[model samples]
Target: MPMSEQRYLVAARKYRPQLFRELVAQEHVTETLKNALRLDRIGHAYLFSGPRGVGKTTAARLLAKAINCQTPLDQREDGAEPCRRCEACLAFEEGRSLNVLEIDAASNNRVEDVRELRETVRIPPQGARKKVYIIDEVHMLSNAAFNALLKTLEEPPPHVLFIFATTEPHKVLPTILSRCQRFDFRRIPVENIVARLREVCAAEGVEADDESLMLLARKGDGALRDALSAFDQAVSLCGTRLRYAELAQALGVVDIDLYFQVTEHVRTGNGAGMLQLVERVVGAGYDLQEFVIGLAEHVRNLLVARTLPDLSLIEAGEATRRRYAQVAEAFTEADLLRMLGLLAEAETALKQSAHPRLRLELTLLRLASLPHAVDLRRVLEQLDRLAQSAPEAPAAASSSAAADPSRGRTAGLSRLSTPTGSTTPQPAAPGSNLGSGPFGPPALQVRPSEKPGDSLAQATQSAAALMVAEAPEASFETLVSRWADVVQQIKQVRIHVGLLLEESRPLRLMHDTLELAVPGEHAERLLRNQETFLITQLHAHLSEAISIRRIRFVVQDRSVAATSAALPEEPEDPLELLRRLQQQVPALQQLIDRFGCEPLWQGN
Candidate 1:
């Protein structure tokens, strides 16, 4: 009825691999089947197991054809394959071979089906050497069905060869499994898929770019049938003049360039750029969850490309491979591991998220902002070595300081910042076990509260007098004893005032007032101005409160040139304060000298 009309075959059906050599990435199964046939060692039963669309069924069919080919003598010794020109091959090709039966066990998995199959197995072949029964998705058979078929499977009729193909081999009954020789088929590599697709396109007179072909191959996820399906879809949509953009648009897949750009953004620590890229992805109507998945895969590819020397492991075009190699050099193995771990976490969380776009953006932002993780092992090893060397240090250091209880004098107070532009180590607190060392960080000393008041200072005087009456040792000497504490206390209020106090020492400790000698008048100016603030902090800090009526600042004879008299007897002017500060601190002087620095103050 349709002699004048013809129908077009899909790429998957049209270019299906007919010969063992044509099977992509299934050489193991092909070679074994061919070898078994060559040695006349064809078994009674065979089980093909692997992922879907990865040649499990195809291998089973090919094995069946090879076993029953009319020209068995033609491939008697080696390279055994069905000659398609022969009677049996032609019958199989035309789907009219009574000897070869393919059953979708998913639709026929019942005890009755097994009983019917058992009855069919008892019959002998008419023309072929044996009758082949291929059961696809054999695991779908019910337990009763499996049990019913077990006996016949174990000791089948000599002319009947049972071939089972399933994605899940574990679901097959153990009894059934023992009878069948299993062949596990592997996923086709991207290169193999591309190679096969190129041949198909060439034969069909289709024009396609390598990038577009690669996209189709990758979309298949190592399934040649799936790839052909994708290829057919791309060819149909793009009318054989296939471009990468059209293919990507047709498949709704994010381009490799976007993934690389994301990687580049991560490498460069560009969170904004990564966010922008995500915005574009979202605006284009791509699934955020799928994008996250692809990004995770992209990161994995980079990790593999960076770690492995073999480039064949990565599934992409040559330009993409080169880009991966080039970009992979930017991240170390540790960084790649971190990136993968982060992406994995993102992917797992992305699956259940209701707001996937937000989650994806956050994940990408976090990845983009992620600094290369430190090698904790190396750091721990270094710390262990430091700890080992630490015990010997105090022994060497103690000899350079106080020797006996009689000479257990406290070191003078020091400032965090000094006029010489170098930091001085603060004196250790009383009863502290930690001695001064260059290794450890500067210990933090608790300072007085910064609440603005002179109430504490006034209260301290009366308290000190009472304490002195009870214990005569709690006098002006007590005040000088905790002077460093006072400076630490003052530091909390104003670092500059604490620094000013560091340049001076207690000259005379009278009943009430204390005299301090500073090297510069500038130091004297600052100390005079912040006297109340210092005394308030000191009153709160010191254990025994000693009253300080006034802090009398006088210029002491030191190395620096004297500019003016020590005390001008005036609350110093603001401009005069800046001049004095610049004169006292070399850093401040250099700032003015180099950067044309000046003091700018606003008055209320």
Candidate 2:
């Protein structure tokens, strides 16, 4: 092959898209541009803005060629494409077209440059019908220069066109932006870039695996030009026989295995393996921050793979994608989210840290040690299922859960207290058990009649029920008739409360409030101590029985009448009570004699 026939072209330039239809990942811009050209509704100025290497300037060039191509078919239905064989297209491709000019705004951003441009715009294209000027990084233009060109850009000669391209569109003057039809270019997807790379490789007769191509695509960070450049470097390093290992090593990239190993270490709780992986990466001389970034990406891949159905969003080979999906199953979406968060924090901190390697190691350790964030809703659902299957024994389950090793602290998802949204505790239902379990109280027995060794809760519930039924409101006389029954019921429910009640004389009944005359302050104190509980029981007894919603207990000072009514005819000494108990209950006398018990407390 002759030198003229066989030419050398780098991947970036050799494969650059020349037509509106050929530009990658810019359909919105291309479709609109083609429609505008087809409709002959061309604007005087157009703005193309996006991140670097995402076809901004390229789209501008293609637009210029599409409009300037001389072939009659070029402007037909199969239009918006440059006839590359035409003089206009040929000259434009060679960068020698007098009809089109590309100015680097970073270098020529002064007011004088704008003046020169204005002067040039006045002259028609020497070869083509219209002249187009492409200003790259137009945001670099000085304010004065932007102002100088604003009028010309807004209403240029009919034969002139201006195209502005910028990564930072916000920095461009609002006046200039208003004068142009702006098009935003998006970052090309990694899959698209990889597909393009595969085409390039086949055309070049080079052998590259999917993993190698995937890695190259991700290295581009959504920039096809950058991905091509990286691909070119890979080709240069290994001369087209592209093995993933050599390509990765030549680029000094952390191998995918390291990230995989890091995740595996996290799954298995192996901090040491992660540390060794770091050592291997450091020994290879890769940047720790870069490693952290890659780890974050790895976690991101897992997250998307786990949570989303579209595997195309993940940039990896089929095998790698399968592995990601598999590992993703081991991790919940919440776990992957937590992992990404930790890695991102580490990556950010590494930028500000004095010791990046140590920070990275700490991050790795943290990730490896992260207790998987389990979804509490799912855990609760499982617990509910278990509860239903076994028996309705929350009390026993709760007690057992307190002592059960399996119930202690679950890994991955630790216990978290959630708001039950209830203000007061609800008592157990009539026949249901409270907290009965192997570790809790026995099943609550709803006996028809009271039996020996019944739980206090059951007995209290029974007494409360009986009190509700029998303690009805009546006139003072009827109420006084039931006072002894109230005392007896209280004695059965609680001996101490009943004893305190025994020291009060019913003075008067005023509505639901029971005004009691107490013999002394000692009895009054006891009543006040159990006031809330006593009132609940009293209201339960009195409420529906009377029309009372609440019942109040009031104790007044002992008058002679109250003292006389409340005081039982008895021995004045405490010893007299002991003597009475000894006489009434021989078992109490026997226990007292056996222990040789002495009176520790004496009443006045």
Candidate 1 residue lDDT tens string, 23-97: 889888899888888888999999999988888877888888888887855553345977888888899989999
Error of 2 at 423 (Å): 29
Per-model TM-score versus the true fold = 0.62, 0.63
User: Clash pairs of candidate 2?
Assistant: 395-435, 396-436, 396-437
| Model 1 residue 603 lDDT score | 65
TM-score of 1: 0.62
